[model samples]
Target: MSLRFADGDFQSAWKELDEPQLDGGWELFTETMGVQIHRLYDEETGLYEYKVFGVLAACTPELCADVYMDLAYRKQWDGYVKELHEKDFDGQKAIYWEVKYPFPLSNRDYVYMRERQDLDMDGRKIWVILAKSSTVTPCMEKSGVLRVKDYKQSVALESDGGCGTKVFMNYFDNPGGMIPPWLVNWAAKSGVPGFLTDMQKACKGYANYCQKK
Candidate 1:
């Protein structure tokens, strides 16, 4: 598909979060470190889609966007990343990521296309990063690794008044295996918060890393 993301995609997500119906619509999962996690269940896939809102204290929108797009820097902070790189498949640029899983479960890999847009909404700068799985890529599957065929993620970043960023993320993916639904839900509920924590730490040291380069 297309690498670009429409503004409505993020705006609609924000609207849902703004007027939350926690009873049936977006259920509250957890909150930690200025982050709130909400989940919506899909009847067809029996999987949960996540909407996350957080503030990266003391971080600028530029820095947060840079850190999100920097695959090299991700390897240093994200321990679960087994492999990550960008490649061109018949002139179409895409990213390949292999993530490590716990024991007894196979690792997961994703081939996805991503795009970033710097938007000016009423004179306010908002950085949006959108990514989704691409089936057109000719990348071969690795043995013992499960390729995640369905995945999509979008993140919106904006300034939170003084030297901080407000982040909103909408993510969904299907592991495509015999994995239990409860296990998947549990992983997301726990893993998402941990990721945001790691991201904050990564942002803090990003300037230093750039200086050394």
Candidate 2:
């Protein structure tokens, strides 16, 4: 499923994503193995607002919470790195940090507990969760192609298929007026194949780190 943002349509898309879908399976999976940050850039104030989400797999709720908290902290630190290393479109530089506590939007305290909640919500839940964290990284005049910026550059574990966790990573870029909706959708969809490949690599590294410790 792909969405396009036109003149007045952009705001409509934003409105369309108001309430979260609350998917049981995705919620379970995310509650088990996902972390995300939703950030917004205010050009007028020159400040950024950030919201974070994370889930960890563990036998006990306490352990899962602990791991999740640690992961959140790690993400905060990683965001610092991203800001430090981020390069602006004009080759200029800017730095910023989170302004609020990372909110927890789920009830599952552990991987086991998540099973109690419906993990088969027909996919609506995951969409809700994703919309909350999704960011629109607009295209830069200097960089003709849309690029995902401020990403933590990590990997993910997959269990749908394959023998082990498949790699996972995310990127977001807004093509702005430069690219039409059709082309933007086409380009965005076209990049998925290669993006997933790189994500797998990052996920593998993360899986290793998680296992080692």
Candidate 3:
């Protein structure tokens, strides 16, 4: 991934970070797989804000963050990732990612830049990653794969006061084209929690492997 900033676009994203307003348009959608999910709509943008959070038992903030940032490792565990490849690496970072949609729907893809940091919050050390879709340069955005025009993701991870890790994710994206409302809801309610479950498992693997090393 290209790690360079242009025109301070990333700066603006950092400025917008804040604790979620629990009493906004958000509503408790569903809790499954031990994860709590809340969703809200952005009517003006025809998009939704999905916030899913849970604790990863036996995982550390570093392990959780590492699993997420490792694109090469994602191929092993990301069931929906059809292709995830780093396109370039300079001061700026970029990657090409393609997600497999269930049959009959065209696959979706994104070219995005992800930046991460370790910071202190309320006396707890946490890892934060900010990812935004980009079109910084001519990318190998495959033909026939639908491009995600608008996408933003924030991931925060901190120690769960002990051996485990606490994770919170806020994601907003427009998958483009028409999609059934039921499908969208299902994806958010189930997909979000399922992804977290998988991530928890991945972190466990990392923690175990690191212990052996």
Candidate 4:
């Protein structure tokens, strides 16, 4: 999917994210990017799926593992929590979670950061996983196959300034192909402004949350 961003806003957001104060707030950082949709309570299936795109700053393998474990246990954070299980994936440990949302919404199950091959060869992939419950419909529910989309991560250091990363997320789908090409283009074009605004608030909120912790 094509992502459109303001000339300098995307880059500016990256700089803001790099601040040293954000060290322990990995979950917040990821959510702030607005790349993933978090279904905290799917009443249909009675499950919750928390999703985000993550980039770890100055993180070690142990820290990464601890983060995942905390997420599984729903440690001290607010918003969403689930009972998590563990498994092995490509030799790395992965965490699985089962969440039961309040009734009326669909219940969705999630397999988070299910350790794929360390794509970057850096011992870990800076990403988060959110799943649609088996009971819930898939992206292409008509077919049995699950469609998995991987986000791209880019990190930049400004030398004289700070260092941070940006995640170029996938665009929303236009299944009908009936929407005018120009209209679709406009939506994609206009979407970035809203995305940037949401991201800024999220990032700042995360930074503050980390400070309190």
Q: Pick the candidate with the highest TM-score.
A: 1
The top-ranked prediction according to lDDT is 1
Candidate 4 segments exceeding 4 Å error: 1-75, 87-94, 100-102, 111-113, 116-163, 169-213
- Once fitted onto the true fold, the runs of candidate 1 whose alpha carbons sit more than 4 angstroms away are 1-4, 10-24
TM-score of each: 0.91, 0.26, 0.84, 0.29
- Give the worst 10-residue stretch by lDDT in candidate 3: 7-16
Q: After superposition, how far is residue 166 of candidate 1 from its true place, in Å?
A: 0.9
Residues 1-213, candidate 1, lDDT per residue (tens digit)? 446557677665444334543566788888877788989989989888888888888889888999999999999999999999999988889999999988888999999988887777678888888889999887999999999999999888888889888888889999887887667867777789888888889999998998998
Q: Candidate 1, TM-score vs. the true structure?
A: 0.91
Segments in model 3 whose C-alpha atoms lie over 4 Å from true places: 1-19, 89-92, 207-213
Q: Scored by CA lDDT, what does every candidate get?
A: 0.85, 0.28, 0.76, 0.33
Residue range 79-197, candidate 3, lDDT tens digits: 99998988754455577899998878889998888888777646657687888888664565577789996888887787778898777777899998787888898898878877877
Worst 10 residues of 2 by lDDT: 107-116
RMSD of 2: 16.6
In model 4, where is the ten-residue run with the lowest total lDDT?
129-138
Preferred candidate (TM-score higher): 2 or 4: 4
